[model samples]
Target: MKTVLITGCSSGFGLETAGYFLKQGWKVIATMRTPREDLLPRSEHLRLLALDVTDAESIHHAVEAAGPIDALVNNAGIGLLSAIEGTSMDLARDIFNTNTFGTMALCKAFIPQFRQRKSGVIINVTSTVTLKPIPLLAVYTASKAAVNAFTESLALELAPFNIRVGLVLPGLAPSTDFGKNAASRMQNVFPEPYEAFAANFFANAKNTAVVTYAADVAHAVWQAVNDPSAPMRIPAGADAVALAAQSL
Candidate 1:
């Protein structure tokens, strides 16, 4: 069976994707900052590991625990809803640390193994907002944009080695803690011009019916990892697809 390592399995897209792969008979290493039994569906093929992408030591240990993985899914990320002025420099750093640098580190750590074997795929979970500025979530959008750019660069770099680098840019899914996490920072970031609009915009970002379900993203991820010709970028939601079409 193929082996896939998925980070951030505590809930949302991560957990759903883990279960999907496990059900498909892949050996899955599902990880989270805090691994909880309740967050995952009980499965024989599922191997749980504790991982904090923002924590270097945790990443190293989880990678070691996972051993040789055929595919690496970089999905662990945090959100900050505050605007430029009200948001702390430290807060921006923290978000970038998790969403951008942490993911880059994971790819760096795993690509060596993939290269040695002359095989493997890397799927980085990004966002659709990079297509346009979604008002107050500029920091979050920039973070994902970094991932998108990294994915494109890595795709070209890895292609010569027979390793694939692909990305899934999911539009906001309501059934996730992401919006709440973003909202939590609202009190801090909502300043003058942005204060009036932040709430509804952020909510609409994840209003389920307005977007696709997490399973849609999970399925796209599975397809991206398995398909020989998966595109460098896979739009994981209808919103993403429509927006991508518009951008084109």
Candidate 2:
């Protein structure tokens, strides 16, 4: 059975994708900052490990413990919603630390193994905000956009070694914890005129229907891993598909 190592499997897309792979008869090494056995079924095919994507030491240890793997899913990310003027440099750096550097660190950890094996897959979970600009997401979008560019270039670099790289763009998934988490960390910088505009913008954005489910993201990851000819970018939600169509 092929083995896959996934990051941030405690909840959201990571958790869903881990469950999906286990059902498909694949051995799954699910890593999160906090490992929770109750979050997933107790199966021989599933192993939970602790991984802090932002820390190089933590990443090194987790990769070492994960052993040989067929695929690596860079799904761990944190989102932020704030205008550029409202966002502080420290806050922006923090988001990039998790959403950008974290993903790249995991890739660096596993690329040697994938290269040596000459057969492996890497699926990165990025946001559709990269394609379509939305208000109050400047930092978050910029971070994911970096990952999108990195994945595209890395795909070409690794293609000769048969190491496939794919990117999954998920749209606004209101049902997921991402929004709640982002809201909790949202900067309290809405002062004066910007506050009213920010409020209006967010309210309007939320009014739009949410068609993206966590399962849809997992399905995209599944296809990206199993399909040898999968495109570098895979849209994982209805809104994301529409946005991608606009780009086309």
List pairs with backbone clashes in candidate 1.
82-189
| lDDT (tens digit, per residue) of candidate 1 on 1-248 | 88999988887899889989988999999988778887767777888998888888998898789999999999988877676878887788888999999999999989889999999999999988888777667788899899999889998998888998899989867778776766665565767777667767756654546686889889999989999888778888787888888887
lDDT of each: 0.86, 0.91
Error at 80, model 1, angstroms: 2.2
lDDT of 2 by residue, 1-248 (tens): 99999998988999999999999999999999989889999999999999999999999899889999999999999988877887889989999999999999999999999999898999999989999878878889999999999999999999999999999999889888887877767747565669889878888877988568999999999999999878889999898889899988
**How close is every model to the real structure, measured as TM-score?**
0.94, 0.97
Highest-scoring model, lDDT: 2
